[model samples]
Target: MSLVRKFMTVGGATLGSRIFGFARETLMAAALGTGPMADVFYAAFRFPNLFRRLFAEGAFNAAFVPLFSKEIEANGTDGAKRFSEEVFGVLFTVLLLITIVMELSMPLLVRFVIAPGFADDVEKSSLTVRMAMVMFPYLMCMSLTAMMSGMLNSLHHFFAAAVAPIFLNVVMIGALFYALYTGADPLTTAWYLSWGVLVAGILQLAVVYFGVIHAGMSIGLKFPRFTPNVKRLLILAVPAAITGGITQINQLIGQAIASAQEGAISALQYADRIYQLPLGVVGIAVGVVLLPELSRALKGGNLREAGNLQNRSIEFVLFLTIPAAFALWILSDEIIRVLYERGAFHAQNTAVVASILAIYGIGLPAFVLIKALQPGFYAREDTKMPMRFSAIAVTVNCALAITLFPHFGAPGIAVAEATAGWISTVLLFVTLLRRGHLAWDWALARRAALLVVAAAIMGGVLYYLRGVFAASLASGSPLLTKLGALGLLIGVSMIVYFAVAFLIGGADLGMIRRNMKRKASVEPPPPADL
Candidate 1:
């Protein structure tokens, strides 16, 4: 399949999952608002979610997928499955031990890592510990689920793994609905949500587990053993984990700082959910497909092919990311009011969240660009370099957030995160070029400049439309009316952006269409060393 189609397959599924995630967030906003319960629940949830990314998707999947792909190329399906079985045995044992330790240490973990702000309020701190314990087991389930996803992606089976997240959102939505129907207290509803997370983890694992089975690949467990390959995976994964851990540490810093102010953490979480839509669709989808493809290209000594692939993926990301960043910035308040300013969530909360969203939007492109660029390093098995860059980012984030949060609050932390993202992205780009691996040609550079120009034009139009719809977005207006106005602003801005992009020669719809129709004569590749 072509790169465009591969991205679409993953992006389409991600889009569905994000839509469901929106529904879930909307319900949670209505149910818990920016109240104490919402803060506690979100704080607890962030712990396991952090680990799920750091270990599963961040380190394990990154290391395992490349190695597994190489194994398949060197041997075949049977060899890959055997390797997976060995890895699985080790993965399960480690996860089981971690889960037990976390559950047992929930109170201490909550005290230090999750909610230092709740230190004065014993009741709140206790509730947070309980929620964390309930959600802790999710890490184990999702870790295995991520391995299944890596296995499927390596085999060119994107649909099942990509779609599995829908189950998670669906389960949470159902739990919220139950809480609403029963008129449960916000604290009780939080308990419901925590349980929902655990159940969804199981469902997510099951969905991908069945896909692995259907692929005619088996990865059954045996006694834990660290073979040479497993040890290599561990070495690769450790540096990658530190790299991934930097982002989580930044998040924890933000959350800890935000926790000092009641409702700030919840506010930040809501904004994150909004920005994640485009990030998930473009950045994540492209990164997922790009890594293995680049790995294979480089392995086979197809330097030009790898360079072209990198350029095209960057183009795809910028075309989507730039406009998204502009729209989110211009319509931040309207979008927030329309999507979340009802029930217990009020206009004041909307203002705070919107401010954070706009700041986050400014860095959206960098976030997406980092996703496209990192695979260049990962594909070459250069984990240590990215780890060093990430360390720099973490330093920037920690320093700025700590220094600024006292005066600027959550938006300050948002600024810190965005600043750190650009730092990381620029470092990655410079490293790639200095290493003679990848750099922009003049033609690509010109188009990237044009994309920014086109996005700016769209931003101007959106600013005017925002003024026109100002009254409709007023808090006293009906929700349906606000929704209609916000939708019109977004839809029209999209049209304007695309038209201007084409006229300025920044993009070609016809070229994209042709590319979509064209297929590469290769399947998703196995590892190069293989």
Candidate 2:
């Protein structure tokens, strides 16, 4: 399949998952708001997610995909299958051990990580620690699930991996509803959410396992043994682990700082849910699909093709991301208010969350760009270069966080993160260019600049419309009126952006259409041998 279509297949599936996630977060906000319960739940959830990114998404996939793709190219199907089984056996054992250790140490982990926020409230701190313990085992299930996802992705079976997250959101939403109806206490509800996470992890694993099987790959555990390929995988994974860990550490630092300020962590999290929708759909989908394709191309000594792929992915990301960033910036408040201004969540909370959303919007494109760019290094198995650049970025993030948090509060932390993301993007781009691995095409740059101008115009129109509907939005009496106003704003923004983009030659609708058609006509890249 063509790159655009491949991206769409993955992105479309991710988009559905993100929409369900939005529903889940909305329900969660209404049920728990920015209270102690919300704080505890967010903290508990972050632990597993942080490690999952560090180990599974960052370390394992980064190492596995390229090596697995190479094995498929070099040795054929049965060889790749044997390699997979060996890797899986090792991963299973490692994760099981880590889960046990994490569960036992959950109290100490919570005390160190989230203690600043609960300094004055010992009771809440204790409850958060307990809840964290209930949730820590989720990391093991998700890590194994991620390994399965990596295997599926390598085979170009994007649907199952993409759809798995939807199941997670569905399970969480069900748990929230159950807690609401059962009249459970907030702490109990939080525990239920934690348990729901473990269940969802298992379900997601099952989904992907079947997807691999359906793709004609029979996967099963093998006796663990050290192999040359396994050693290579470990070597490649270490730098990626550090790189991914640095990014998460920056987030953990932000969380730690936010915890000191009442409701700050929850506010950051809520705004994050809003920004994450676009990030997950466009950024992650492109990154996941691009890496294996680029790796295989490079392994086959196709430098020009790999370069073309990189440029196209950049264009694809910027084309969608520029407007997404603008829309979120313009309509942050309206979106937040519409989705979350109910039950225990009040307008004041909405205002704070919206401000943070706007701040996050500033960095959205940069973050997505990093996702597109990093694969360039990873596909080449040069994880150390990106890791070095990430170390610098993380330091910059820490300094900014420390400098700004005292005066600007939560928004300051958001600004710090945004700044760090742009810095990292620039560093990655320059390094790639210096190494003669990536180059900027004039046509792409012109198109990107034009898209920015178009997005600005769209933003201006949405700003004006939002003001015109402000009174009804604030009155909050009629739900339909509020939703209608929001829908109108979104409609105008889309129309204005697309119209301006097309008219100004900022984007080629015909090219996009042709590309989509081409994507439909082509078959997927033949599955990797295993």
Candidate 3:
């Protein structure tokens, strides 16, 4: 398949999952809102998620993919399969042990991590700790899922891994609905959602396992032995793990500090979820698919192709992300109100979350670009450089959070995040240019600039139309008014953006057409001779 098609496939699946996740969050907001229950649930959920990123997605995948790709390229399929089994054995054992320990010590971990938020409120603090303990085992299941996902991605089997996360949202939403139907209290419902995470993780792992099998690969547990390849993976993974861990630690720090201020953590979490929709759809999809492709190309000395891929990835990101950022900025309040302004989520909650969402919107493109750029370094086996840059970014993030939290509260943390994101993007771009891994193609530059301009036009049109519709709808029609206003605004903005983008040559619609016309233009070379 062409790069665009591959991205669409993965991104389309991810988009489904994100939409379902939105529904899940919406239900949670209606049930719990931004009160103590919401705080405890968000805190509990974040604890396991932080570790999942640190161990599974962050450290292991970065190191494992390149090595696994190399083995498949050099030693063939059987050799790569062997390598996978050994690594899985050790990883499984280690994660199982860690989960037991974490489950046992969940209270202490929560106390240290989110203590400031619960400083005086002993009841909420204790609840958060207990909930976190209930959810801690999710880390083990998701870690294994990540390992399976990496294996499937290496074989270009992106569908199962991409689609597996949808189950998470599905299960969680079902559990929440069940709790509500059963007349459970809000805290009881939150606890059920926490346990649902463990269930979802298990389902995700099973889905990916079957996907691997259908793709003609077998993975199983075997005696754990440290081969030279495993040793190299560990060596590479340690630093990468630290890098990933530190980035999460930075977020944790922000969350911890924000917790001290009432509702700041929950506010930050809501804003983050809004921004994450686009980030997951565009940036992460590109990163996941591009990294292994780039690694394979670089290993084969195809620097020109690698550069072209990098350029295309950047173009693709700009095509989607620029418009998304503008839309989020313009429709921040509408988006928040539509999705989360029901039940306990009041008008004041919407206003505060919308403010943070707009701030994050300004940095959405930067965050996505960071994902696109980092793979260039990772594919070349230079994990340390990105780690160093990440350290600088984290330091900036921490200092800004500390300095701003005293004055702006939760919004201050949002500002700090945006600032850190831009700083990291700048550093990554400069390094890529200096190292000659990427260059400024004037065509790509012109197209990106035009995309921004078109998005601005869309934003302006939507802003004006929202006012017109607001005035047209009377005060008594609250539900219809909000829905009508949002629908008209989105419909007009989309039409304008797409029409302008096509007219101004902001996106390569023609290239996409050609790619579709010639379906077999670039076939895989017989699975790398394995």
Best by lDDT: 1
Candidates ranked by TM-score: 1, 2, 3
Best by TM-score: 1
Output the better candidate (1/3) by TM-score.
1
Write one digit per residue (lDDT tens) for candidate 3, span 48-119. Answer: 888988888877667888888998999999998999999988888888889888888876777777556685
lDDT of 1: 0.89
CA lDDT of every candidate:
0.89, 0.84, 0.82
lDDT for position 9 in model 2: 91
Candidate 1: tens digits of C-alpha lDDT, residues 259-299: 89999999999999999999999988998888888877776
The alpha-carbon deviation from the true structure for residue 208 of candidate 3, after best TM-score superposition, in angstroms, is 0.9
**lDDT, model 3:** 0.82
Tens-place lDDT digits, model 2, residues 1-530: 87888898989999999999899988888888998778877877888888888888888668888988888889887888888888988888888888888888877777787546776778878877777777767677777777778778888888898898898899999999999999887778888898898889888888888888887787788777778999888888888877756556677789888888877888889999999988889998888899988888888777777887888889888888898898888888888998899988998999899999998898999988988898899998989888888888888888999899999888888988898889989999999999999987898899899999999999889888889989867745477888888888888888999899989998897657644543222223445776
TM per prediction? 0.96, 0.95, 0.93
- In model 3, the clashing pairs are none
